[model samples]
Structures are given as C-alpha cells and as structure tokens.
Target chain A: MFRAYSALIRKEFIQVSRDRNMLRLIFLMPVVQLLVLGYAVNLDVKKISLDVYDFNRSQTSRELVDAMKAGDYFIPGEEGQTKERRPLWHLADRFQDGSAQMAVIIPEDFSERLTRGENVTIGLMADGTDANSARIGLGYTAQIVDRYAWKHTGLSPPIGIRSAFLYNPETESVYYMVPGIVATLLTMVTIMLTSMAIVREREMGTLEQLMVTPISGFVLLMGKITTFAILGLLEMVIALAVGVLWFGIPFVGSPLLLLALAVLFLISTLGMGMFFSTITSSQQQAMFLAFFSTIFAMLTSGFFTPISNMPQWMQYITYLNPMRYFMTIMRGILMKGAGIADLAPDIIALAVYGSVIFSLSVIRFKKRTE
Target chain B: MNDKIVVQVENLTKRFGTFTAVNNVSLSVRQGEIFGFLGANGAGKTTVIRMLCGLLLPSSGMGKVAGYDILTQPERIKRAIGYMSQKFSLYPDMTGRENLYFYGAAYGLGRKLIGERVMALSERLSLREFLDRPSKGLPIGWRQRLALAVSTLHHPKILFLDEPTGGVDPAFRRTFWSTLYDLAEEGATIFVTTHYMDEAEYCRRISIMHQGQIIELGTPHELVKKHRAANLEDMFVDLIRKRESDNA
Candidate 1:
C-alpha cells in the first residue's frame, strides 16, 4: 500500500512539474496577491475627501472646520459658500460622484451652542452605499474631532479612551489577509488541478485504464493528497516569504508548528476536494464545487472580520469550516507569534476535520465489483 | 470445461432505482479465446464490462471473474484484469514513455519492473522512437496500439477491450488483431467489443447485446447459420427486426 501510494504521489508530482503555468500559479500568484492586498487593502480609511457645507461663518464653526482637516483620514476640500439652505444634499451628491467620500455639515447654530457650553453634535453624512469604506471614514472622523476639541479648548477631559484592539496589534491588513488568501489560493488551485486530473482522465477514457490496475482507492487518495500537499506547502512558503520580507509583516511562530498545522489543513482541504471529485462527473462540476467551497471559506472564515463579531449561531456554524481553523493557525503564527501550546485546540480541530474527510473519501470509493 | 470458464455471470442484473441497465443475464467467457461483444450504441456492453471489472454492483444475482468471487475478490479481479476503453485514454501532454511510466507505476510496479516492462512494451509496440514524444502528437494508429500495450502491461489473465480500435487505420487494426492473437497464444483470454463486423470474424465466438440483454451468442459461422444470413451485420439486422416484430 505504501509503495503504491508513493508511486501515485510521484506520478502526481511529475504531472504538476510538467505544467509550468500551474507551478507559477501555485507560488507566484499567491505572492503577488499577498503583496498587492497588503499594501493597498487597508481597514483604516485614508485620504477620504470631505466637502464642507459650513453655513455657520463664526469662529467656533471655523474651529470645527479646522478639526476635520487635522488628520490624514479627512482631507478638507471645496467649501460651498451658497445662499441655498439645502446645499448639504448637493454636497452629498459630490461625495457620491467621487469628488468627495464624506460630507461634513456644520449647522448655522453651531457657534451659539458651543459658547453656551452645550455639546454640539456635528452631522457627518457618509455615503454608506459601500458600508466598509463609510464605517472606516466615520470612525476616523469621530476620533480626529474628539482629539482636536480636547486639545484646542484648554478643557482637560476627565476620561480618555483606553482601547484594547484584539488579534492584530499593528492593525496591519497583511497580518490578517495573508492567511485567508493562502487558504483560498491553495483550495482553489490545488483542488482544481487535482480534481481536473481525474476528470481529464475520464474524458480521455484513461480513468478506466487506471481503475482496472492493482491500485486501490487508498493508493489513489494518498497520491493526490501528498502531491497537492507539497504544492500547497510550496505556495504557502512563497506567499509567507513575500508576506514577511516584502510586506514586513512579522512571522514569529515556530517553523515546526507551522509545518504541522499546514499538513492538517491540506489534508482536510484536499480530502474534501477528492470527495467532490468522486461525486462530480465532469470538469464543470469540479470547477463549480471548488469555487463554491472557497467563497464560503473567504466570507465566513474570519479572515476579514472578527468571527466573534458574528452572531453566536454563525460562530458555531463556522466551527465546521476547516478553513476557519486554518486561518486561526495561520494568523496565530504569522501575526501573534503563537506557539503550539497556544494553538492546541485549533490543531485538534483541524485534525478532526482531516481524519473525518480523509476517511470518508476512502470509504466512499467503492470497488467496481462491490 | 470449468477451468475454461474465465468469467461466469449468472442472472446478473444492474438497476438504478427504477431504471434497469443490464437485465437478468448469464454468460461466460472461455480461457484463451477471443470473445467478441457486438451491439449498437447504448446497448450496455460498457455497463457489463464495468460490472465485470467491479465498477458497479449488480442489482440481483452474482458472478465470478478469473476464479474469484465477484463480491469477495473485487480488488483481486481489478488487479488481475486489463481494460482498454473505446475512447483514446492516453494523456495528451505526457510523452508515450511518460504515460507508460505513470500507468506502470499506477499498477504498483516498482522502478526496476516499470523500466524493464516499458522498454519491452515500447519495442514491441514499435513506439521506441516516439516514446519520448507526447502521445497527442502521434497518429491515431500508434496511439491506439500504445493504449493497448499500457492496458496489458501487468499481463492480466482476462483483458477487456471496449471498442479499442475506433480511429485506427485499417493496417494498424490488422496489426492490433495480430497482437490480440499473440496475447491469446500466450493463453490470455481476450474479451473485445466492436461495432465492426469484420473484427467479429476474428473472434472464436461472439455475442450480440441489445438493450442490455444478450439476444444472440455463438461462433460467428454458427450464428450466421442459425440466422441464415449473409454476414454478421445483416444477421444482427435480421435479429433486431425479428425482435421488433415479436414485440409488436
């Protein structure tokens, strides 16, 4: 069985090595995506253009106006000095049209309310059509204004915000995004290529030729898993290097722990793929299922948002996702410098998924006479 | 006589829920004989081969392939049999040598055995020069011959060829027949299916399956004599017409 499985694995490696494009995709595409996403895709919104609709020309309103421009998040732009009372709507359109992203509306009563020492709530109209961008912009605006008011007013605030952000310290998008993208990339390409190899054989009518041989399901699955695990590992290494050196994200975990976790992740991922292949009759079905499995992995896998932020029920559902634990292991190692002792639960979860899926795939493949 | 029976099927049936593929049927293939299975498309020749190869479970009844119980020794039968499909199954990107190597390895032959057998098979298949070139670039004739060589690499006792010579030139088809005879001479049971009537003439005995039931089974001459037909194709037409007439 071992000899048969090793032979099968070797055959898979030969097939993968011959295709230069697959090799390039397994390594290069992940690295490029990791770098581009790390540098460009940020949770903190910067350079948000704000159109000022300042009807209050008093010194207090001017101070509010000055507060908006004090941070990198809010860049003060065209001030509409119009007699029209409804200039705020027109300014909202400009924000929608990309001239600005956020519109700051200063009420005409702003100067009088501040002199009376009453707290003035400044209206911030953000286009929440794209909610993520809008939320980031809104948070930045609130933070900057609070700081400016306390600094300029000579009012020593009684309380300060003591915020403890969880997971990522630098709030670097790379630290969070790299793990998810790696999972997605490996799941996408490794499955497509591995599953497609069988599909093509069936199309070519060569699968029957292989099936008739002494090779059993155990041998075939082992070959597929080993070959894909190597490719998945290779891709992870390349993506990790780019994440570490190019993006300057720290990789502070033990290499042995990372390697061990990756094996469990690849097994569960490839095992699911082989199960899909067994059910799928054609390349189209394989491709469709591969796409379906990974999108849910990306959206629900807690790579972008806090899984804790999800409802309690959704958090329970995500436990079934092998990708969720893989992302946990990846982020734990890559970002927080977590060790094996800290990640024992995640390791056990991945092991369960792998053992179940691998066993199911092997058991599912019936010998023709049976 | 019992030793002569390489495969024995008794009232074998295959059904998918409500649909019946291979109806209750019994058949046997003799050792060291060219058994021809002839039928129109969708007549379940492929289905029977799959069942014999342990690809699908029979709905009812039982069978034995190569002296092993179908249910108990399926893995053994799988290891013991060779199958050449109608469709060209060779990988397009791998050279003839590479494909042969992969298939050989898949059969669980180690490095030394694979090397020796590939060398021997390549020379016999006359693919020595082109083994380094991908199978896709080879002509249809060489491709079919190469596929046959790969299928029989393990020297299985019973070889099933499902329309193995669809696209080969007539000359290679003749050469293919000669190779089948050579393998048969070595006491290998060759069970082949084809739409071609002339190929049926080369078989020691033949069976025609229609809608999953074996309608006619005999030596080629005996079948012609029984139907009082000029040739196998006309005999098949006569049988089909008789069945239609009987159904009506």
Candidate 2:
C-alpha cells in the first residue's frame, strides 16, 4: 500500500510540476487575493470627507470643527484637498459629484443657545449611497457633537455607556479580512485542485487504466487527496504569512492549535472536491461545479458578511455549511486568542462536517470507480 | 505455450440499466495463446475485456482468470493480468519513464524490481530513445509502444489488449504484432480485440461478436473455409449482415 501510494503521489507531483498553468495558479492565486482583499475589501469606515458649513463663524463653531477632526473618523474639506471653505450653496454640487460624503451645518445662533443653556439643533446631511459608511459617519458625528456640547455647556449627561472592543480595538478591517481570506483561499485551492485533477485523469481515460491495475480505490484517493491537502495548507501558510508580515495582523492564538484545526477543515474541503469529481465527467464541468459550491460556501460561511446580519431563515441554513464553522474558528483563534475549550462548539461542528462529508464522498467515489 | 486453461467464463452478462451490453457470453482461452476478439463498434468487445479485467462487475457471471475468481478475487486477477486500454491513457505531461515507473509501482513491484524490469523492457522494445520525453510529444506509434511497455512492465501471466492498433499505420501495426509475438513466445497468454481482419488472421483463434453475442468462433482459416468467404473481412461483413437481417 505504501509503495503504490507513494508512486501515485510522485506521479501527481510530476504532472502538477509540468503543467505551467496549474503551477501559476497555485502560487499566484493566494498572493493576489491577499493583496486585493486586504487593501480593497476594507470596511473600517475611516477618513470620511466632511464639508463643514460654519454659518455662525464663531469661536465655538471653530472648536466644534476641530473636535470633529480630532479622531481618524472624518477628514475636513473636499477629497482632503483645498481646506479653504467653499460656499454653503455648493454643498448639493459637492454631494452630487461624489467629492464630499457628508456636510455639517451649524445654526447662526449656536453660541447664544449655549450661553442661555437652551437646546440647539445642528443640521447634518449625508450622502447615503454607501449605506455602511454613511451610517457609521452619522453615528460618529453625533458622538462628537454631544461631547463638544458637554464640554462647552457644562451640562453632563445623566447616563453614559462605556464600551470597549476586544480582539480588534482599533477596528482595523484588514485584521478581520486577512483571516477570512485565509479560510477562503484554503477552500478554493483544495476543492479546485482535487476535483480538477481527478476529472483530468478521467478525461484522459487514465482512470480506467488505473482501476485495471492492482491498486485499490483507497490508495488512489489517499494519494490524490493527501497531495491536495498539503497544497491547501501551504496556501494557508502563505496567506497567513502575508497577513503577518505585510498586513501586520496580530496572531494572538496558538499556532499549533490553528494548524490542527486547519487539517480538520481540509477533510471537508477535500471530500467536497472528491464528491464533485464523481458527479462531473470533464475538467470544465468539475471546475464549474466546484466554483458553484465555493461561491455558496463563501457567502454562507460569513467570510465577507457576518452570519448574524443574514436573515434568520438563512442563518439556520448556514448550519449546513462547514466553512461557516471554520470561519468562526479562524477568527476566534487568530483574533481573540481563543483556546480549544473556548472554541469547542465550532470545533465540534467542524469535526462533524468533516467526518460525515468525507466518508460520504469516499464511499461515492469508490462506488463510481467500481 | 501450454494447454492450461488460463481464462474460463460462463454465461457472463452485463447490463446498464435495461440495456444489455454483454449477454450470456461464454468463452475460454488457453495459456500462451493469442486469442482474438473481433467486433465492430458497440459490439461489446471492450465490455467483455473490461469484465475479465475486473474493471466492471458482471451483472451475473462465473469467470476466472489465472485461477482467480473475477468477482471475488478481483485484486488477485488484476495482479495476474496486464490490460492495455484502447485509448492512449498515459499521462501526457509525464515522461515515458515516469509513466512506466508509476504503473509498475501500482502493480506492487518493488523499486529495485521495477528498475530491472524497465531496463529489460526498454532494451527489448527499443524504447531508449523515447523514455525521457513526455508521452504527448512522442509520435502516435511511439506513444503506443510506450503504453504497451507500461502494461507489460510487471510481466503478467496474461495480457489483454483492446483495439491495440486501432488508428496506427500498417507499418506500426506490423511492429506491434511482432512485439506481441515476442511476449507470447515468452509464455504469456494474450487476449486482444480488434476489427482489422488481417490482425485477426494472426491470432490462433478468434471470436466475432455482433450486438453483445459471439456470432462466430473458430480458427481464422476454419471460419473462412466454413463460411466460403475469400478472407476474414468478407466473412465478418457477411456475419454482421446476416445477424442484422435475422433480427429484422
């Protein structure tokens, strides 16, 4: 068994090495995706372009503008250029041309109201095209305005809520996105390589030739999947390294624990790949099927969006997606420094998915080959 | 070169859904004999070879190859036989030597034994010039030779060749036949399927299958004389036409 398995693995490695396109895809895919998702898919909602219309032009109004600029949340002016104030009537033009995302208008009597201890309402308008950034920008504006009012008016609010964000206190979206990208990269590489490799053999008619030899189906499957598993782990390591070295994302958890769970995650992905190979007759068909499944797996896995934000019914359906548990496990371990006990439920779910899907796919593949 | 019965099958049947591919076929081949299976396209020749090689399970059959049951001892049967599929099935991206080593290892040959066999077969088949190049870049005849070398690396007691010379030129076909003769001379039973009448004439005995049933089986000379035909091709066409009309 060992001899046959080794020979099969050696043959696969030779083929993969010779195929230039496959080699390019294997190494280049993770790096490109890491750079794209790390830089472009950011959701931290920083550096909003704020257009301030200071109608009063008072000392207090200037102080309010300074307070708004204090945090990294807002940048005053148009596209961070030309700090000289533009006419207030041009606000509509600015929002339409996409130069400014938000504008704040202070009432002319803003200082008189504060001196008399009377309430005043400042007008705030936002371009709501990107609802996420718009909503977050508005919330930040409210907090800044309230803090400025409390400081100047000498009136403290009755109740206050102090909330601290753990894991990612600075709220750098790259830290969250890098781990999700790692999970997705592993899934895509393993599923595409395993299914396509097997289907390629079937296309060349070598699968029948192999079956006619003395090698058992078990040996053939292990040889193929084991190679792909190693490749998937290699891709994950590359992605994680980019996350650490390039993105400077912290790895607070145990590296050994992460590696162990990653192997467990591979069982399901490789099984899914084998299952696709059985159902597909050609490399293109296998590729399309694998792609379709990964898209669903990614969306439902909460890699881009949180599962809690999905519809309640859709949330229940996510229970069937193995990547969902893996996504949580990745984030939990890498970001929160979670241990095995802290991630037991997710780990248990992932283990169940891996074993059940793997056994089923193996059985199906054997039956198909026979 | 002996009279030992190396292949024996009785009422072997295979069905895909309701379509019967090999129906109630029975045949036996002796040790070291070049047994020919002649049939047109979709005539169930490949189906029977696949069944005997244990790549497909017969719907119902009692068959044995090299004294191992095809149904119960498929792995042993696989070890005892070398099968060359009709399609050119070697890995195109891999060198011929790599393909040979892979299949050799698949047949459970040790690395040392595989190296020895590969060396011997390369010399015998004159494959030294093509072993280092990828199989895809080799000419068709050279690729076919490489495939044959791969199958025979383990030196099985029986070898099955399905349409071994389907699309090759006549000169390459002659060379392929000579290689087969060499193997038969080395005490290996050969089961080969082809539609070429000239190739069938080279066999000691041949069976003509039509629509999942063997319509005629005998020595080529005997069959041609018994049917009063000029050659094997004429006799095969007559048998097929007769069978089609009978069904009609």
Best lDDT goes to which candidate? 2
TM-score winner: 2
Residue B167 alpha-carbon offset, candidate 2, angstroms: 1.2
Residue B12's C-alpha lDDT in candidate 1? 83
Query: In each prediction, how many residue pairs overlap at the backbone (N, C-alpha, C within less than 3 A)?
Result: 3, 0
lDDT of 1 by residue, B1-248 (tens): 12589899998888877877888778999899899998888888988888888777778878999988776677889878888887787877778877777787777777788888888887777778888887888999888888888888777899999998987778989989998998898899999999888999999999998878998899999999998999888998888878779988
Model 2, CA-based lDDT: 0.84
User: How big is the positional error of residue B153 in model 2, measured in Å on the Cα after superposition?
Assistant: 0.9
Q: Which ten residues in a row have the lowest lDDT in candidate 2 chain A?
A: A157-166
Which lDDT value does model 2 have at A280?
89
Docking quality of model 2: it rates as medium
Interface RMSD of predicted model 1: 2.4
Q: Can you tell me which runs of candidate 1 are displaced by over 4 Å? A: A44-171, B1-3
TM-score chain B for all models: 0.95, 0.98
The candidate that achieves the highest DockQ relative to the unseen native structure: 2
